[model samples]
Target: MIEILDPAQLPRARAVGALVATILQTAKARCQVGTNLLDIDAWTRSMIEDAGAESCYVDYAPSFGRGPFGHYICTSVNDAVLHGLPHDYAVVDGDLVTLDLAVSLDGVVADSAVSFVVGQGRPEDTAMITATREALAAGIAAARPGARVGDLSHAIGTVLRAAGYPVNTEFGGHGVGSTMHQDPHVPNDGRPGRGFKLRPGLLLALEPWVMADTATLVTDADGWTLRSATGARTAHSEHTVAITRDGAEVLTLPPAA
Candidate 1:
């Protein structure tokens, strides 16, 4: 279902977006070396509860994943990319971790993700993270009224390809409203001037993720975590954007310190 928030609801959307962004930033800061994945999940839960917000992922039962995600946040490390279920693992130095989070505040939902290295950052891993972040920015910049969804995808794709990374479309961005995932699927790559046209008040979660070597993905035994087929490092970056009259407003920015 595609949901377009009324102008009055936009404030609630912004509130929810801020909450998600704040939690993600806090979780990213706490992802130090030797940090357990479960700990991050727990911390996220506490933050969500303290804010009187609801987690979009806790009882999420999507077909692509195992029913009931049962986690407060998605902790994707190293080769793992999407739908990373938190497990009993400690991050080590040089490990690339991706934190994806979604939450609802005042009945509006916002989703975002960030990928970074733990202790000592590696050149290649850092490059991959930068590429995904750049791609995400490109997508957001393309999200304006009258622009087609393909325009956003193409803008995002151009950057990833220029960075020499393969774009995976199996799982990309989606419309976000009262629920987590909604209609108007946004791929990482597509032709411009095609697909759904953007409209004011529309909310879209634009995510761009890339694997180092292959576009193929393998599901871990846990039936949720997605890893690169070649076991190469990966990175993902995302933001929830609201379509506006003049341009797109990125709602998932972290609160100013």
Candidate 2:
């Protein structure tokens, strides 16, 4: 369902967004060569409880995934890109990690994701991560009252394609508000001047993800994690944005220290 949040709910949205961003940043900071994926999940759980927020992923059960995600955060390493269910795995140096988080606070929900390398990053991986981040920015920049969903998608695609990465539309961004996923599926690539028209009070989670060499994806044995078909490294970047009278306001930015 498409939900246009009221001004009264905007503050709740911002609060949840801040929580998600803060948790992601904290998880990223603790990622080390010997860090365990389970530990990250535990840390996320604690933070969510301490903040009096609800994890959108812990009980998530979608058609594409196995029932009940049973994890607090999505820990994607290397080729693993989307829906990365946390498992028993130790992070190694130079491992590319993507942390996707969503939470509900005061009845509002926010979602965001970030991709980064653990230790010394590889040139290609760094470039791919930069490309997703740039695409996400482009998408947000295109978001404003009266803008069409295609406009945002096109802007995101232009950046990813230019960076020589294949775009995958199977899993992309979506509208977010009281729930984690809502209407207006925002693909990573699309033709401009099409799809849903942006309006004030609308909230969209614009994510731009890409596989280094191929667009195809293969599910892992766990039936949750999605990895590059060619075993190529991947990256994803996302943020929850609110359509405002002036422009798009990013709700999921990390809180300033």
Per-model TM against the reference:
0.99, 0.99
Residue pairs of candidate 1 with colliding backbone atoms: none
- What lDDT would each prediction earn against the true structure? 0.94, 0.93
Error of 1 at 210 (Å): 0.4
What TM-score quantifies how close candidate 1 is to the native fold? Answer: 0.99
Best by lDDT: 1
- Show model 1 residue runs off by greater than 4 Å: none
Candidate 2 C-alpha error for residue 77, in Å: 0.4
RMSD (CA, Å), candidate 2 to true, equals: 0.7
lDDT of 2 by residue, 1-257 (tens): 99998888888888888899999999989989999999999999999999999999988999998768889899999999998988889999899999999999998899999999998888999899999999999999999999999999999999999999888888899999888999999999999999999999999999999888999999988889999999999999999999999999999998788
Off by over 4 Å in 2: none
Per candidate, the number of residue pairs that clash is 0, 0
Report the lDDT of model 2 for residue 244: 92
Alpha-carbon RMSD to native, per candidate: 0.7, 0.7
